[model samples]
Target chain A: MANKIFLVIQREYLARVKKRSFLLATLITPLIFPTILGLFLWVGMSDTVGENRKVIEVVDENNSFFLESNELYSFSYSELGQEDAKLLVQEGLRFGFLYIPKLDIQNPKGIVFYSEETPPISMITNLEASLQSKMESLRLQASGIDPLLLSAFKTNVDIQSIIVSEAGGERISNSVVNYAIGFLAGILIYTFIFVYGNQVMQGVIEEKSSRIIEILVSSLKPFQLMMGKIIGIGAVGLTQFLIWILLIGLVSSLVMGYFGMKMPQQQMLEMSAQQGLFPADGNPEIVEILQMIQGLDFVQITLTFLIYFVGGYLLYGAFFAAIGAAVDSPSDAQQFMFPVTIPLLVAYMGLFIFVLDDPNSNVSFWLSIIPFTSPVAMMGRVSFGVPWHHLALSISLLVAGFLSTAWLAGKIYRIGILVHGSKVNYKVLWKWLKQN
Target chain B: MEILSIRSLNKSYGSHVALKDFDLSVSKGKIFGLLGPNGAGKTTLIRIVNQIIDKDSGEIYINGQALKMDHVRNIGYLPEERGLYKGMKVKEQLLYFAQIKGLRKQDAKQKITNWLEKLNLSQWKDKKIQDLSKGMAQKVQFIATVIHRPDLLILDEPFSGFDPVNAEIIKNEILELRNQGVTIVLSTHRMESVELLCDEIAMINRSKKILDGTIQTIKEEAKTNVFRVKMIPDSMEYVPMGEELRRQDGMLEFKLELKDQKPNELLGMLMSKGEILGFEEIVPSIEEIFIQKINESHGE
Candidate 1:
């Protein structure tokens, strides 16, 4: 019996793996994110392709202030009227023209930027900052206060978040990193179950609709067939997922290397260090980030993920298989699919709302413990640190849930696989379930 | 030796009784026809034997041993609604089924090649089932069914989707397999094929077996003892020692009461009246017997 199931699994796996669609999907899926990211970065960087400098015509009616020019924008002070400067911009000669009317330094008004197109906010802010600083230093001089002393007193403060463990070890915790990891893991589980679980369903439906189930069931039991197909397709999903992870990591690094762009982690570390958030002795933030990652209990989370991934898939996969057997065609499956997918949808929503927002909340706890939702929801909670007892209880319940669902679905599948040309409903399925 | 035996088998779906007290015994190397009208529980009986479904109450024995899951390895079933994986190549599909039936990988590969060649489907081995013509696919399904060299083969309406030429080829293959000591249980509504092949038969109607026996024995038991006799052109209108049923083409047909007199004595009496041109006893076909038995049971 076990050998037969293995043969079925082998057939299922080999058939899917050999398909062009599977190969295309598996190969392209990992490249999609990186390729899109690279495309966007290319587009963003190419925006600097035009004239290397911006020529801003400054018309200061006060005639007492002089503006400086930088590499990005060159200031052209002119006694010419504002109307003439606007014409130069309209004729595409100047990038933009700034008109600063004479005003009280205490309360400036009617300070307008006149141009054919709206100037970028950064250019406008630079102009405003330059003028404001000059005005401030003049005011300090008039009040007999030293401008250099006041400038020396200015300081930028940085707040650091450090997690002090019970073991007297300090680790920096980045909320953005935690949120990203949890979110991605949760979504991955959700997508895996949805995508691969449907593959299991479609496989069963294909076998059933094509009448191959008749030959299949004659040699092997229906439960064995169901389990074999579920496991087979689940393995396919896992293979694709692992490949995607490895390929995405490899491809992104290669692309970044080609462009001489630093890794995002290194960039973040360098930026924080330049801001004096970390001491120059050693990059403690990088070390702390790594420690915090290690302290997240990935071994437990990953092991639970695999267990729940299979468990949730089996639990839902049995019903999907049963649904496949019960219907005559793919369209007929729609009516039965709603109820089967409800728990998965709920788990997905709960992951975003309850688990992500507050992983230790009662809603998250209940959702994670329930077998149908646990596969996704528990992964969400695991990244945020799940209690050992909750993880144990959830895994145990998921196993039990799979067995019972398998039993129930086996009954329906046994009868449904043989029957054709009738509109089977819940009543008929109930009757089948009760039969020997 | 009996290859398969079932006693007092019963099965039901919900409140609908599909089979009641069904008993059958198929001897080795013989074609056993399971005859029934639509919804007459033929599929139910076949499924029970194949272990595709469970029996509520019964005992089934294969080679004098109680039926077990492992026995499926020794039995091949081609269901009425038969098909192969449409997206799978013929060779791979056949090999998969062979392995599922407990053949080793090398053995399955060998058997697949042999069956493909034997069925004249070697060229189509690498082609997907969807690409094959309906008749060609049917041939592939037949090969898949028998590739494992099962001891007992059960086919339900195996010829439903085949053309006459393909049907003849399959019929010949079935006979060839039977010649190799394979016990075959054929369930179909095509009585002509039944007549051409079946050594013994059991007719089912409304969830019960109404009649069963060798084809000849059932015909003999249901005979009216009628005979057709043709006389010379110039002959007396002499009557035999029986009731005259009809006269056609210079032939005289009559029904005799064998209870009172022997067939030899009746022939002697007829010989004295006219030159015996033709004399033959008429036997009922299985089709007629089936309809009669079913009508009888329905009436009861």
Candidate 2:
């Protein structure tokens, strides 16, 4: 049986890897192709649009405004008349003409911008903010009050969160960091499960449509075939992911090297700071953020992620295979998708609503403990920090859930692969399950 | 020796019985034709033997041993809805099937090459099955079925999609395999092929074995001992105790039942009444027997 499964796995792996779409998707999917395309686009755009900064000619009636200039746009205050500024813009000497006719401060009106194209909203909004503040200060001055006192009332407040571990060590922790890790790990599991799970589905459909299921089963059990396919496609998914990481890393670094752009060397900077070569103490928040990141238990997080990643895929992939077997085509598989997706949707929503915000909440506890939702919901809680019992309970339940689902799915798959129908529903699926 | 045997195998889906109290024994080296009307549970029986599905309550033995997973390698089944992976090269697909059935890669490749060449498909081995004609693809499927050289081969409608020339080639190959001491169970509705190739046949109808025996025995069982005699009678008025079928210019054709009479005695009695032109026994074809048996079982 093992040998037969290995043969099946070998065939499935080779068949998919040989397709042109696999290579194309691997190269284009993970930011590598787009990044290279962006590199060329950046180079091309720099020659035309980057070199010429947009210059706006301001014709202020009061001549009291001092407009600031930036790299993408420049402000030119001209004593020239409105008509002359419009003429300058029409003559292509300026990108736009901003005419601010004497504003009645209380009711500012008749401010217009004339350009060949519509001015960006950012440019208009920036101008409005600057002019509004200026008018407010002018109003304050007319009232015989110092605007500096209002500015003195404004101060910056930074709230640094500190967490006291059970071991009695208090450290400044960043929720942003925790959220990032949890979100990344959770979404990765979600994406990998769907992508690879669909691969297993499509593979089953292919075999069924081609009428190879019966012949295959004659040589080995249907369960073995389904498993071989799942494992084989999962291996391919892992292979593609690793290749994307390697290729994207290699190509992006090469491009960055060519342009003499250095990545944020946080580790190098921290090393220098520790060696007293560079004083990162200037930014206390940065030091604390770095330390908090290092303080995270990546070993535990990574281990759980791996366990659930495979576990989640197996759990959902079995259902996907059964669905594929039950339907005649990919389009026909839609009716069966809703039920399978419910648990995933609940887990996804639950991850944000409960797991991330309050991992220890009862709702979060239930979501993590349930096998269907735990693969994703548990990841968020794990990243925050979970009691060992919760982890053990969830993992154990997930295994039981997977075994039962696999058994159920195998029964359906054996019959469904041979069943040809125009319509299949939950009733038919139930009948098939009872057939066992 | 019986290489394949099924005793009182019973299988059903819900209230619908597929196979019930089915019994069959195929000798070591012969093609046993499984004849049945559409939806008569022939495929179900074959599936049970292949263990693709389980029998509700019965026993199936391959080579005098209870059927088990290890017996998979001993059986090569060509399902009615047979197919090769369309996007897969013929050689690659064959190798996969062969290796999965427990053949080493080198030996499988060798056998695949020989089968492909023998089937006039050597030039098409590198092409994907979709690229080949239907007949060419069928040839490839046939090779895959027998590449492992299984002891018992169960083929369901193996000739359904093949053209005459290819079907003949396949028939010859099946015969060749039988000559090599392989037991084959062939399920098809084509009665002429059954008559031409089958050594023994089992007729399944309405989830039951209605008739079964050697091709000759079944045909003989359904025989009427009737003969088609063509003669030039001495006198048209002296008609015998036989139905006149036709009169073709001095030839009197009629059907005569030679029940319990020796061929010589019947010939002697007929010779005196007419100068016998032709005297031939009327035997029922398997097709006729099949239709008759099915209609009898259906009570129509």
Candidate 3:
């Protein structure tokens, strides 16, 4: 049986590997993937990439409000009337005209800004924030507090989170870093399950529609055929991913080198920042991002990710194979696909609403524990630090889930592949399953 | 010794009975024809023998041993609904089938080259199955089935998609393989092939065997004990002992039942009536027997 299955796997792997599409996808994905990511990054981080900051002509009647200049906009306080400042904006001399009229400080009415284009809410919020703080200080001064001392007492508080291992090792941590890892790992598993799981389904359908299924089953046990196919297609997926990893790594390093980008030194600097060995840099986020990345438990994340990756693919792949065997064609597969797709959708949505928001939430814990949802949901929680016991429970359930699904799918596949009925339904599938 | 034996094997799907208490034994190195109308459980029986599906009850034995997973390697089955991977090359596909049936790679490669050459497909070995014609593809499927040189070959409608010339070629190939002592189970609706090739046959109707015997025994059992005679009449009014079935050029054909009369007695009576041009006992063909068996079962 083992040797027969190996032969089948060899055939499946060779058949797929020799396809033109497989070669094209394997070779081009690394290039297109980075290009797409770069496009998104260039579009998403427009501010940091240096677009011109708009200037706002400010007409402060009381000279009381002094707003800060930032990357998006700069404020120029001009001794001019509100109408003149508005005229300057209308003539395109300035991007905006901010009129801070002399009013009762308590009520603070008739404050407006004029611009040819509507300002973003974030810009308006920024202007409101600085003005609100200034008004608070003025009100405190009205209560006879010394303004200089009030300013001196206004120091912002920041809390740094440190994750301490039971053995007393400490590592600086950030929720954003956990969120990013969780998001990436979850999406990767989700796509992998869909991509390769569907490939298994398509393979079964191909064998059936081509009328080679009975010929195959006659030569080998249906379970062996199913298992061989799943493993074979999975090997293809793993091969493609390994190639992508190598090519992407090689390309990125070369490009980074070409641009004189230092990575190891950057990681070192991030490690030092984690130790607070250097003073805060010009932008605190630079130090914080690197430190959070450096403190990540990647070894744990990688091993767990791999387990879920294979476990999830196997678990879902069996059902896809069963569906393919039960149906006559891809169209017939639609009716049976929902039972598999819904749980994945739940896991995907639950990753954001429950796991990513608060990994310790009861919903996240249950989602990560349940076999159907764990492959995706657990990845979202693992990066956020799941308890070992919980992790163990989830992995065990996933294995059991795969075994049970394989058994069920094996039953369906053995019977379904030989019987080609145009009207195969749940009742027929249930009958097929219950026969043994 | 029996190359394959199935005893009291019963199988069902839900409330539908596909095979019930089916018993069969195929002698080694002989072609056993499994004849049945559509939906008569022939496929079910074949599938059970192949162990592609389980028997609800009963046992199958091959080479005096109880059937198991390993027995599949010794049995080559060509399903009625059969095909090869369209995208796969002929040689590669044959090798895959051969290896899956337990042939080593070196043996499989040598066998594949020989079979391709034998079928005049040597030049087409590198081409995909989809690129081959229907008859050529069927030939490729045939090679795939026998590439491992299995001890027991089961062919279900093996020549269905082939043209007459190709079918003759495949029939010759099957005969050649049988000459080499490979037991074969031949199943098909083609009675001519059954009559020509089967050493023993079992006719099934509505999931039950209605007739099982060697070709001669089956014909003997199915005989009506009626003689067909053609003669020139002494007189237009003179009638024979039997009813005239046809007449042409002053000669009349008659069917005479041999009821309570010896052959000499019947011939003596016919001789006095007219000159006998031709006289012979009517032996039924397998096609007639097949139709008769199915009709009788349907009547039941």
Candidate 4:
């Protein structure tokens, strides 16, 4: 029996691996992530490379005050009249020409500026302020008023955030890591269920509808067949996913190294900004994200995530395999699949809401501990510092749930594989489970 | 000893009965034909024997012991429905099925090679099933069914796609297996093949066994008391036997119904007439018997 099952697994692996579609899908899949990332980067950087925007002309007609130098903006004297300067600016001779027109000895209102496009508001405001300050200082010196009072009014300060734990112990904030952990956890759970669950369903449908499953189940027990299919397909999925991760990592490093781009550091900083995307207000989400990333019980979270991912995949994959066996065609499988999938989907939606509101809430904790929902919920709690004991409890519960659901699904699979020539409704399926 | 005996089997699909009180027995080395028309529950009985499906109420004995799960290993079944995995190579599929039938890897490989060579499938062993033609695939399916050299072979429509030459080859192989003491339950609608091949037959129609016996006995049971008499001209018009007579193509042709009359009476009449060209008793073919039995049962 074991050898038969091994042969089945081998057949499943080789058959799928040899297909043109599978090869294309697997090999082409990794290229997609990097290609999409590169395209996005290309579109964003297309307009900015090797282009400088700050150009300024300083009149300095009387050399009353030499224009203070700046790196971003260049200073040049206006050699032409205002109209000619305006034409020069329009014709790309310069960004703009600044003329310190003949001013009244005290009022200083006669200044001219000319440009095609409007200058950046910050640059325009800064230039205007600086010009005014120089003029005022010059006027003040001429009028003989003291500048000592204004110098005494200036001071600068930087603030840091601190958080107090439940026991009133203060710690430096790690908000960015917390949110990063949550986001990564949620994304991983979502991806595993979707990818592996669909694979199980497609495998079952292919075998069942093609009428080869009867031959398969004859050699291996139904449960053996189901388990082997799930494991084999899961292995294929994991292999493909790991390959994708490696390829993306390789391409990203190459792109970053060759282009002299600092994407990883930028990504870390952007992770902090991503708290805004989560919509937490005045809560120091950056510190929370960082703390979650750093202070998370790594061993507990890793074990729990692995357990939940495999458990959730098996729990859903059983039903997917059952659906595959129960229906005669893919279209028919779709009808049955929706009802089974919705719970997982609802768990996901609930996890999203729970994570955003209270990542460690009772609802999130209980749901994550349930095998079907654990993949999403436990990952959510991992982002919010789940205790080791609770994580262990959740993993245990998921395992229990996985085993029971597998039993139920195997019952259905046994009956559904032999049934043909009729539509199997929920009621009929329920009866088949009881009788078979 | 009989290799398989399905005694009074009964089965149903929901309320629509597929098999009712169907009995089949195959002696150790005989090729047993299971003749039936479409929807005659031949497949249902075959499945039950294979343990692929269950018989609601019956006892199936294999090798003089009641059939059990382990008995499945002794019976090789080729279902009418094609069961090969289309994506798998022919050799891989053959080996996989051989393992399912309880062959060790080394044995399965050796046997698979032997069967592949025997069936002239050596070149196509590495080709996927989907790449083969229907006949080629059928040959592969045939090899899969018998690769383990099972004691009892249950083949449903085994010759479905084969042309005469290929069919003859398969028929010879089946006979060879039978010669080696494999009891075969061959199901098909092809009565000609049944007549040429089967020693005993049990036929079902409308979920009931309509006939069961050795081919010779069933043909005798279905025989009408008629004999054809052929003679050159100058025959007596009257005869002691029942009358059904006609002449054509410069010969006298007539049917003598011998209800309680001896066949020699017809010979006597022909001999009394002009020199008898030919005279013989006509035995009904299995084909005619099947048609007649079904028509009589249906009142068609």
RMSD of each: 5.0, 4.1, 2.9, 8.1
Off by over 4 Å in 2: A31-157, A167-172, A258-260, A265-278, A281-288, A349-369, A378-387
lDDT of each: 0.84, 0.87, 0.88, 0.75
lDDT of 3 by residue, A228-279 (tens): 9999998899899889889887776565565555464565665576766644
The DockQ of each candidate is: 0.81, 0.76, 0.85, 0.38
Mark the regions of model 1 whose C-alpha exceeds 4 Å error after superposition: A47-159, A164-170, A264-298, B233-259
* Candidate 4 lDDT, A1-436, residue by residue in tens: 5765676677667666667887787778777877787778776676454256456777665467556656557677756667777777788978887888767648777676777887778877877888878777678777886666655765765354464556676544344555666667667767777777777877887777666766655455778788888877776766776777787777877766665675544544665687744344534554354443444457766666666767778777788888877887777876787766777777778776876467667787777676677777677667455666777787777778778878888888877887776889889888877864
Candidate 3 lDDT: 0.88
Clash count for candidate 3 is 0
| Best-to-worst TM-score order | 3, 2, 1, 4
Classify candidate 2 by CAPRI docking class.
medium
Listed in order, each prediction's TM-score against the native is 0.84, 0.86, 0.93, 0.77
Provide the lowest-lDDT 10-residue window in model 2 chain A.
A261-270
Clashes by residue pair, model 3:
none
In model 4, the runs with Cα more than 4 Å from the true position are A18-28, A34-175, A259-294, A418-431, B233-241, B259-262, B295-300
Give candidate 3 misplaced runs (Cα > 4 Å): A40-51, A57-63, A76-102, A113-118, A254-285, A288-291, B268-274
Q: Interface RMSD for every prediction, one decimal? A: 0.6, 0.7, 0.7, 2.3
Q: What is the lDDT of residue A425 in candidate 1?
A: 95
Summarize candidate 1's per-residue lDDT along B239-276 as a digit string, tens digits: 66567777777777665555566778867776777777
